[model samples]
Target: MKTKFTAILLLQLLLISCSGTISTLKKEYSFNTSSSLKSNWNFNPKEWALEKDTLTGTGGPMHWGVIESRKQLPENYEINFRVNMTKESLFEVMLNLDKEKYIRTYLYQINQNIVIGDGVYDKKDDSYGKRGGKSLFTKPMELQNNKWYSVKIRVQNNQLYFSVDNKITLECSLEKSNLSQKGKLGFITNGETKITDLTIKTL
Candidate 1:
């Protein structure tokens, strides 16, 4: 009986230790200059700039590109940013980037059509593998071009939360074992985009 009691106590202690780091730590960010923005990112297609505290990028032949953080992110945290567009475009937040695989949370719009959704994707051998991609699980919201939208994302414990304009709009489980606890955080865009106020904080 004493041995069994001791085993249970050890299990409890393990659970507590795990939960200790689940309490997130915050990251601070402020837009000041072009160097500050460049210092925090790694981008492809190599045609992007930060001017007047706004970041703009456009240089991919396929009209698509990715800009990733220089540092990896913690497992559980909140990230927020504001974006604007001059024309129809696709914008995405790529998180938990474990090698060539990651989770994509996107807000896509084209000539008055819009979608707010997410998917799991892998890029290997010049091909894309998508599994359980619920790319449109909600209604399309009418968004004005050249107008900024406040977007927020949070991952805590076993769930992912999404919000726009300060309203929570979606939730999904983070159940994939391959999804790493530490990975790159970044944004994907097609053609032209202007982003500002990128901030992240731990849960």
Candidate 2:
């Protein structure tokens, strides 16, 4: 009777420990820069800059150094953000897998079209695997220029779900990519754009 009781107690302790570990692994994002309108980030002339916006405070000219999350993120999690397109052009928020290079997955846009694409670097060929990569998903919805639109993305395992303005747009599953690396999350803009209320929650 004592042996059985001890075994049960041990099992309970193990379960509790695992639960605690999981709770710790799921973490909230610490925004590196919070902007109102005319906001400026780490002014690296070589990689990033800020452009003026007549409607908004300032448009971010993000290139390589304007990353938000340097901390490791949960593999399977949800990410959402509010982006204000002050100027009409192509933009993206990227989750990258390369430490030395910018190989990553991107949520893309050009005028009103939205797309999700991935880029990889090849080792054997010693070149970037896919130039613009392939579109995993696309949406016909048009984004209004100079308006704020809420974007939501859920990535769990190999599946991805994308939504705009609280409406489901596309869903896709990816064949496991060989290049696996924990990466930083950031925004990408070609002409001019502003981002705010960026929030990420773990599943």
Candidate 3:
């Protein structure tokens, strides 16, 4: 009887260990209400608005806008969101941002080219200074305005992966970059765009 009891205890301990290994870092945002947005994000009220479960950003020429999350992200994680560009312009996802450095994954609507790069942040001006970027595709991909597209980004062990509609995938190495390992997530736009269904999970 002692032997059987010991075996059962061992099994229970093993099960507990396995369960503890599972990740517990899933977060979802539907953008269905203003309370959550007001509490969790930083953005300019004049440039961004929430309507019908969508967060819309309206930027004019020389007037870019950014909506940054209040929570700092984990070092290794995945992020997903849906975006619709109301007009052809620059849309970028900023990651691992500190006061002095950041990583930018951006798509140019005019050419449909996806690019990733390292950026210098100017804290005094609250603006980006200089950046060096690389295009993911040799040829320009086809993209259209006024349509929703699903975007996914994964960061793991100083590696970054980006995808659009699960059709085009790009990877980059952040080992030598100056960006922080864990930092805030943000969206930057230079024209009108709408976003919804943002989610993030740790690896």
Model 2 score (lDDT)? 0.50
Model 3 score (lDDT): 0.70
Off by over 4 Å in 2: 1-28, 32-68, 100-111, 120-132, 176-182
Error (Å) of candidate 1 at residue 115 is 5.6
TM-score of each: 0.69, 0.59, 0.76
Give lDDT for model 1: 0.61
Candidates by lDDT, descending order: 3, 1, 2
Question: Any runs in candidate 3 off by more than 4 Å, and if so which?
Answer: 1-31, 121-139, 177-179
Error of 1 at 38 (Å): 3.3
Sorted on TM-score, best first, the list reads 3, 1, 2
The candidate with the higher lDDT, 1 or 3, is: 3
Cα deviation in Å at residue 30, candidate 1?
A: 7.1
Please report how far candidate 1 places residue 44 from its true position, in Å.
Answer: 4.2
What is candidate 2's CA lDDT for residue 186? 54
Poorest 10 consecutive residues of model 2 by lDDT?
Answer: 52-61
Q: Please, what are the lDDT tens digits per residue for candidate 3 over residues 1-203?
A: 99999999999756533331212244333244677677777888888888765788876555567777777778788877788888757788888877656787877777777767775545235433443234433225677788888999999988888888898877877776444566787777778888876667678
- lDDT score at residue 142, model 1, on the 0-100 scale: 68
Overall lDDT per candidate, in order of appearance: 0.61, 0.50, 0.70
